[model samples]
Target: MQRWKQYGGLSGLFAAFLAAGYWGFTATGGALPWAKRSSKALQRGIQEGGGGLVNLGRGIVVAGPIRKGGMMLEFGGLVLLLLLLGIGMYVYVDRYGGFGDGERASR
Candidate 1:
């Protein structure tokens, strides 16, 4: 019972931290918030430029500025995703013993 409570508390704390960071960064227009704006900018760039994915014959080539912004967004998102995944895996391993009882049945 105590272990369950600890696990629950940890999970809640992680969630709250993630939510706060996302909201705070977005509100402050930080680098992380650039991810959302990238999609819109990509569309506009395609519309203005003569090259885009849809026009496969010419091959897709995003504008230099838009591409640079997108790379930053992608890198930031990758870091966040990796962080969450690592935390989740750690929680799972902690909740259920990673190396289970090997040969203690007779004991």
Candidate 2:
């Protein structure tokens, strides 16, 4: 595509290098090491502090989890933040329109 070509050749080369690195890592038996490390680190930090920035934001969106007949749904913490982020995005699009249209009301 012209857009891909419009990017300097280095972009394509960089993408190729990234793909090759991922392929080599997978071939060498690395199973999503980045994801594993990030999750463990996040969990450790949260456990040590009992709550972090995400917890604060979650508090704004949810009071706590809800429990029903033997079923429980976690609404507080990161889950609430994610929900808030999604709803915020929807509200933004509803007010300002979505991507790819390029037209917007002048401020």
Best by lDDT: 1
User: Residue by residue across 37-101, what tens digits does model 1's lDDT show?
Assistant: 88888888789875345666764554577667768577668768999999998886666655466
TM per prediction? 0.29, 0.29
Give the per-residue Cα lDDT of candidate 1 at 28.
94
RMSD (Å) per prediction? 11.0, 12.8
What residue runs in model 1 are displaced by over 4 Å at the alpha carbon? 1-3, 30-57, 66-107
Q: Candidate 1 lDDT (Cα, whole model)? A: 0.75
lDDT for model 2: 0.69
Q: Please provide, for model 2 over 23-82, each residue's C-alpha lDDT reduced to its tens digit, 9 standing for 90 to 100.
A: 999887686787897799889867877544355546432222343332234443557789
